[model samples]
Structures are given as structure tokens and as C-alpha cells.
Target: MNTRSLLHHFKEMKHYFIVVVLVFGFSFYLGWANSASFSHFLKDQLAGLETVSKTLSNKENPQVWFFIFIFLNNAIKSILIIFAGLLLGVWPLFMLVANGMILGYVLSLQTNENTLSIVMKGILPHGIIEIPVILIACAYGLKLGMLVWKMGVQLLVPPERRTASVEMKRILHLTKPLIVGMVVLLLIAAIIESTLTYWLVHL
Candidate 1:
């Protein structure tokens, strides 16, 4: 991709990228600095995760298992929603909101497990890059969705004059590149969530 095309791609995903920043920024300001809440958040997240892990009865290698779960949980669904939303932007909103809630809840634990610095250890290394990528993917998905919406509105209104077939073809072209970008993104996120998070929490 040339400079102009790259800029255009970023422009298309501006909204979602903005949302990612806002969410994490809000989280940091509200929860990360608070001593009590941060402690509670870590303990609660671990406790809840422990229960879930036990229910599955796969208690083989805990560190590895936790990493797998953490990375898989966010990455898989995030990728799915992004891909699906190429045709329907609304789909990823559900994933984003749901994941946001889970993140809020997890970060909000605020228990005594060294939650303040720990969260940083868990997030900053990989999250810094991965999150923006996720946001961009989501934005692209939403943009694609808007194309469909624009056509639908045109159809509902007067004469469907938006030339959707041409737009649809263009959207398909965008999908391949977008998916590649998102995959690279999620891979980084998984690595951080799995390896970095584990070490941070453990040590």
C-alpha cells in the first residue's frame, strides 16, 4: 500500500480507532490509578477465571492454559465480528460492546493482587499496538456496513440510485487486506494476553 492508500484506509477506520482509545483511556483514568479497586479487580478476575477453568476440567498446565484462554477469548470473536461486519457493521458493535463490558469488569476487580502495576504489565506491552489494529478492523467493518446501509436507505427512499453493485465489489476488495491486518493485530494481542499477562500476573 502506498502512502495515500494507507492514509485512506486509516481514514475509513477513524471512528473505531477513536473508540478503542476512548475506552482504554477511560479505563485507565477511572480504574488503573485507584488502589483499592485495582486490587479488587485482579482478585475477582482471577477468582472468576479460576472457577471457569475448573468447570472445564482441563487443569493441565495453568500458565499456558490461562494464556490460551485470554488470547483466544478476545482474538477469535474479535476477528469473527470484524469479518462478518464486512457485510453488516452492526455485528461488530455487539462484539465490541460485549468485549468492552468484559474488559471493564475484569479491570474493575480491584482486589489485592497487585492490580495497579499488574494491569500495565498485562496490557501496555502488546495492547498498545493490538488495540488500535482491532479498532481499525472494526472501523473498516463498520464502513463496509455503511455501504450496505446507504444502499438500503436509497432503496427505501426513492430509486436506489447509489450503484451498490459497484460499491459492493469495492468492499470485497477491501476485505482481504483488512482481514490480513486484523489477523496480525490479534496475533500480537494474543501474545501479550498470553505471555506478557501471565508473567506480569505471576511474577
Candidate 2:
């Protein structure tokens, strides 16, 4: 899609993005206020995530390998989120909330000033780019879900008035640029996280 069309798509989907952002904030607050209970409830799932986090935290991996790992991990996540949107958008919403809660719980576990500093250093460098990209991806997922819903609604209208095909085309048009943009952004984020962020944290 051209720049104008891309911009229009983003503008049209602003409300969906806002909804995801609100849901994320609400989930974060819930996690922060009830971290112990929430953590206990999700202990099994969290354990696996913790293991992966620890592995990624180590600086021993070569930059290229680390970059590849990060990029692939994020790319897979983005794709999954978009696909989940096909399920009436429920999965994307759940993923957003789960991620926000996890972030809040992790931040809450930092008990000391030194630990907080270390965590911030490790996250902030690449997080500035990575987090926003993730949010945008979720927003796009929600948009797809909305499109699915619209298509369903249109199917009920008279054949002459129905515009399902047009909606489908619009969805594809928006999705193409969104996927491309997200991939490029994630690649940049992976490079920053693997190289610069790692160096900063270790220093």
C-alpha cells in the first residue's frame, strides 16, 4: 500500500489501538496489585517464561545468534497474535493482558534499587522500540478481528448491498503493510537488544 493508504488505515484503526492500550494498562495494574495471587495462579506457565528469560539474559551468546533468536521469537509472536485475531479477537486481547500482567509482576519482583537499575538498563534500551511494535501488532490483530466481525454483519444484508468482498480486500491491503512494517521494526529491535542493550546491561 502507498503511504497515504497506510496512514488512512492507521487512522481508521486508532480506536482499536486505544482499546488495546487501555486493556494493557488495566492488566498491568491488576498484576501489580495482586502479583502474588496472579503469580501463583500462573506459576506453571510463568516458570517456562522465566527459564527463557534467563537464557536470553546471558551475554555469552554471540551477537548474531542472539539477534536471530530474538528476531525469530518476536516474529513468531507477532504472527501468532495476528492469527489469534481471526478468532474473533479474543486471543489477541488475552495475549495483551497476559503480557502486561507478566511485565508488571516481573517489575514488582525487583526488590532493591540496584536490582531495579539492572532491570531497567536491560529493558529500556530496546524496549522503547520493541514494546511499541508489539502493541502495534496487537492493535493490528484487533483490527483484523473487527474486520471479520464486519464481514459477518455484512453477510446478513441484502446481496446487492453487501460489501464483504470490498471489506476483505481492505483487510488484506492493511495487513500487507502492517506485517512488513512490523518485521522491519522487530529486526531493528532485535539488533539493538542483542548488541547495544546487552553491552549496556553488562557494563
Candidate 3:
């Protein structure tokens, strides 16, 4: 897609993006406020993540392994969520809330002077890119979900009134560029997370 078309598509998706951001922010606040009650559940989740990290850290080239793992995990999930939006956009929305909660809970646990430093050094570098791309992917998924709902509703209307096909074509046209942009950006974010972010956190 040309820059103009891409920009237009994004403009069309601005509402969906705003919905995602709001939902994420609310969930993050909830998680932060209720961290004490959510401690056990969140700890289990964090422990599982730590296990995966440890296994990858033991690899011959841990940094490369980390990069590959992070990129694939994010790329595959982003693609899946877009399709899963066929289920009324449930998956992508759920993912956004869940991720936001986890981030909030993790930060809540950082009850130390180093909290700001950790966020700056460990998250900011990659997260600035990673978070926005993920949010955009979720917005696309939500838009697809809305389109699918319109498709269903159009069935009740006269055949001449149906615009679902046209909307679907627009989404299809944007899909190639969207996926390519998401994958490329996620790759770069993963590299930063695995290499520079790792070094800074350790230092």
C-alpha cells in the first residue's frame, strides 16, 4: 500500500484504536489497584515466563535465541488475533486487557527506587515500538470484528443494501501492508529487547 492509502486506512481505524487504548488503560489501572488480590495468579503467570526465559538463556547464543523467540511469539500471536476477530473481536480485546494487567501488576511489584530505572532501561527502548504496533494490530482485529458483525447484519437487509463485500475488500487490500509493517517493526523491537535492553538491565 502507498503511504496515502495506509494513512487513510489508519484514519479509518482511529476509533477502534481509541477503544483499544481506553480498554487497556482501564484494565491496567484495575490491575494496579488490585495487585494484592491478584498477586497469586499473576505470580504463577510470571513464573511460567521466567521458566521460558531461563531455558532460552541457557542456549548457546542466548541473545539470538531470545530475539528469535520474541519475534516469532509476537508475530504469530498478532496474526492469530486478527483472524480470531472473526469471533466478534473477543480475542484481541482480551489480549489487550490481559497484557495491560500483567504490565501493571509487574510494575506494582517493583516497590523500590529502581522501579523508574527498570522501566526506562528494560522496557522503554523496545516497548516504545512494541507497544504501539501491538495496539495497532489489536485495532485492526477489532475493525475486522466490527466488519464481520456488519456482514451478519447485512444479511437481514435487502441484497442491494449490502456493503459488506466492499468493506472486506478494503480490509484485504490493507492486510498485506499491515502484516508486513507489523512483522518488520516487531522484529526490530525484539532485537532491541533481546540485546540492548538485556545489556542495560544487567548493567
Candidate 4:
């Protein structure tokens, strides 16, 4: 998309972005306040993920393989979140909250003096790009959910009054460029995460 179109799209989606941010903050608060209780629950929820993370962190895969893995993993997640918007946005919101809570819980666990530095080194390299991309995906998902709701509402009106097709076309128009941008950002994020992040953390 051109700069103007991109800017307009961002403005149009601002409310959805804010919703995700608010939910994230709330989830973080819950995780921080109930860390003792939530920790156990989150542990159970994330057991498989933890195992995979550990394996990845330990293995010294070639950069190309690591990039491919990271990119595909992120791409699938983004697609799932976007598609989940069809469920009236609940799925995307739930996923965002879950992820936020997990992040908060994990952060709460790091109590050592070097924790801040370690976390920064590990996250900052890729997080600056990845986090925003994920948020944008979630925002678009929420927008899609809203569009679906609007379409359903339009169906209740007379055939001449219905605008579902028009809405669908608008959605597709906005989504195509957003998805392309997200893929490009994710590619950069994966490269940074696999290389720069690794080096910084190991240093």
C-alpha cells in the first residue's frame, strides 16, 4: 500500500488496536497480581511450548533453517489469529490475553539482578518489530470480526439495503496489503531473532 493508504488504514483500525492494548494491560495486571496461582496454570498451559523453546534454544541449527522455522511459525500464528476473527473476535482477543498473561507471568519469575538485562537482550532485538506486527494482526482480526457482524446485520435488512458484498470487498482490499506488510516484518523479525537476539543473549 502507498503511504497515504497505509496511514488511513492505521487510523481506521486505531480502536481495534486500542482494544487489544487494553486487554493486554488487563491480562498483564491479572498475571502480576495472581502470579502464584496463575503461574501453575500457565505452566500447565505452556508446557509444550516451554519444551519447544528449550529445544530450540539448545540446538545450534543453521541460520537458514532457524529462519525458516521462525518465519513459518509466526506466519501460521498470524493467519490463525486473522481467521479466528470470523468468530466475532473472541478467539483473537482470547489469544492476545493468553499471550500477555504468559509474558507477564514469565517476567514475574525473573528475580535475579541480571534479569532486566537478560530480558532486554533476548527480546529487544526482535520484539521491536515482532510485537507490533502481532498487534496489527490482532487488530485486523478484530476488524474482520466487526465486519462479519456488520454483514450479518445487513442480512436482516431488505436485499436492496444489504451491503455485505461491498463490505467484503473493502475488507479484502485492506487485508491484502496488511498481510503483505506483516509477512515482510515477520521475515525481518525472524532474522533478527535468530541471529542478533541469539548473539546478544549468549553474550
Candidate 5:
């Protein structure tokens, strides 16, 4: 990213990071709260079981084929997230929240009975990239969505205001570049997350 883009990104990202830190702190707090509960032990066991199920499911498929599928899915999800931004302001917020909740739950569960280093080795390598990319896409979509609705309040010629065709074409023009850039970034993240990151943790 250029200096301008970098600055713009940080400006956009700062609030989101605040939310993330809150989620992180929340996870740690939840872990402590659950320390004495049977619920904690149960949920931890369930998470482990789910992880094993996922592992077995992966074992049934060739790794290359799985990665190919994951790559396509990542692109599709990014596109949907971007497009969703155009319609609903809170859609991206929902997407980000869902992502955050999963990570939070995982982190909270980690405190039940596992080494921090092991958890980091397992999660952070690709997560460091993948999570932020998802958040960024959601943020961009949120901004775009906000603009689409807010910009519609004023009309230049009353009834002869911007036509649907003109507005849609303009939105497409702007959205194309973001979509392409997001897809490329997501693909790179998928590759690192799927192969390199997993291997680092398990191998």
C-alpha cells in the first residue's frame, strides 16, 4: 500500500481494532469466569470433538482438492461480503461480529487446558492475515453501504435526479477494483493458512 492508502487503512482500522481488543479481553474474561464451571469443561470437550470431526472430514479428501475448494469459497465469501455492503449497513457488522465471536470462543476455550504457545502455533500464523483481511473487506463494504444510502438523499434535478443506470454503473466502477483486490488478498491468505500455517503447527 502507498502512504495514503496505509494512512487511510489505519484510520478505518483503528475503531475495528478497538473492537478486537475488547473481544480479546472479553475472551480472557470469559475464560476466567468459566474456570470453575462444568459448562466450561463441557464446552471445551465439545470444541475438541468438533475439531476432531473436522480433521476426519479433511482426511477423507485430498489436501490439494480441499485447498482448491477453500480458495474458491474464500473468493465467493469476499464477493458476497463486498456486495452485501451495498444493501445493508449492518450486514458487514454482522459478518465481522460472527468472525470475532468464533475467534473469541476459540481463545476462551484455549484457556481451559492448552498451552498458549500451542494455540498460537495452531491459530495465529494464518489467522494474523486471514482475520484482518476479512475485517478489512467487511469495513470497506460497510463504508460503501453507508455511502450508497446517504448519498441518495439529495437530487440535482428533482424527478430527473440520478437514474438507476447511472448510479449502478458508478457503483460497479468503484466496486470492481475493491473486489479484485480483496479476492487476490484472500487467496494469498488461504494458501498461507491452509498449507504453511497448518504445517507449522502440526508438523
Candidate 6:
């Protein structure tokens, strides 16, 4: 689809997108507020990520491997969450909460003096794109889940009240362009994360 078409679709789904963002924000707050409570679980999650980081860093062509790993991981997860929303949209929302909480917990670990530096150099470079892309994907997933839910509800209603199928088709069609756009943007984000962010953090 064309850029204008994609933008239009996004505009139409702004509410869903906003919902996804708000949930993440709230979840982040929860994580930050209850850092101690979440410490154990979050630490395990971070440890896994750290392991991956170490492995990637040890690779001969670490930068290239990092880019590939980051892109594939984000892209695949985002795509899966979107389709998985068919199960009442629970998975996508759960993922957002999990991710947001982890982020909050991580930031809570940073000292005040270095927090800004870490965010600016270690995250902002690629996160500006990656975060939004993930949110958009989740929004689409939530939308799909809602439609499926509506379809279930409409089973008892009259045929004339059944619009879920049409909306489902519309969303399915839009996914083509959405997936393409997400992949392209994620590629750019991964490159920046693997190269610029990595360099900045180490420097």
C-alpha cells in the first residue's frame, strides 16, 4: 500500500494505538513503583538478555550478528503478537506489560547520574523507532482481537449486526502493508542499535 493509505489506516486506528501506549505506560509505572517486588523476575529476564548480549559480542562479526538478531527477534515477535491477538488480544497486551515493566525495572537499576546518559546513548538511537513499531504492531493485534471478540458477541445478534467479518478482512488486508512497513523500519532501527548505540554505549 501507498504511504498515504497506510497513514490513513493508522489514523483510523489511532484509538487502538493510544490504548496500547497507555497500557504500556501504566505497566511501566507499576514496574517502577514496585521495583523491589519485581526484582527477582525482572532480574532473570535481564540475565537472559545479558547472556544474549555476551554471546553476540563474542561473535567475530558482532555488529552484523547483532543487527540480524535484533531485527529478527523484534520483527518475529511483533508479527506473532498481531496474529495471536485472535485469542482475545490477551497475548499482545501481556507482552506490552512484560516489556514495559522490564524497561521500568532496568531504568530503576540505573543511578541518577548515568540514567540520562544511558537513555540518550544506549536506547534513544534505535528505541525511538523500535518502541513505536512494537506499539503499532500490538495495536493492530489488539484490533484483531477486538474484532474476533465482537464476532463472538455478534453470534447471538442478527445477521445485519454482524460487521466483524468485514472489519476482519479489512484488517487482514492492511497487515500486508503494515508488515512491510514494520520490517523496513525495524531493519533501520536494528542497524542503529547494533552500530551507533553499541558504539555510543561502549565509548
By TM-score, the best candidate is 6
Q: What is the TM-score of each candidate against the true structure?
A: 0.67, 0.87, 0.94, 0.87, 0.65, 0.96
User: What is the lDDT, from 0 to 100, of the residue 156 in candidate 1?
Assistant: 60
Alpha-carbon error at 136 in model 2, in Å? 1.2
lDDT (tens digit, per residue) of candidate 2 on 1-203: 76568778788778887888899999888877789889875566589866876776665666766788889999889878986887888888888998888877777777768656856788887888888888888887787787788878888888888675676677767777777888898999999998898788778
Per lDDT, the best of the predicted structures is 6
lDDT string, candidate 5, 1-203, tens digits: 33445445556557755664565456445544454443554466458647754774567554555466667767787678767878855677666655555554556555445757656676676667666666666766666566676557545346656464465455556556666676777788778766776677667
Model 5 regions lying over 4 Å from their true place:
1-61, 112-115, 155-171
Error of 4 at 190 (Å): 0.8
- Where model 2 places Cα greater than 4 Å from the true spot, the runs are 53-62, 112-119
TM-score of 2: 0.87
Q: All candidates' lDDT scores?
A: 0.63, 0.80, 0.87, 0.80, 0.62, 0.91
lDDT of 4 at 90: 85
Residue 101 accuracy (lDDT) in model 6:
95
For each of the candidates, give the backbone clash count.
10, 0, 0, 0, 0, 0
Worst 10 residues of 4 by lDDT: 57-66
Cα deviation of 74, candidate 6, in Å: 0.8
- Quality of model 5 by C-alpha lDDT: 0.62
For candidate 1, give the lDDT of residue 202. Answer: 63
Which sections of candidate 6 miss by over 4 Å?
A: none
Give residue 172's error in model 5 in angstroms: 3.8
- What is residue 140's positional error in candidate 2, in angstroms? 1.5
Output candidate 6 Cα RMSD: 1.1
Clashing pairs in 6: none
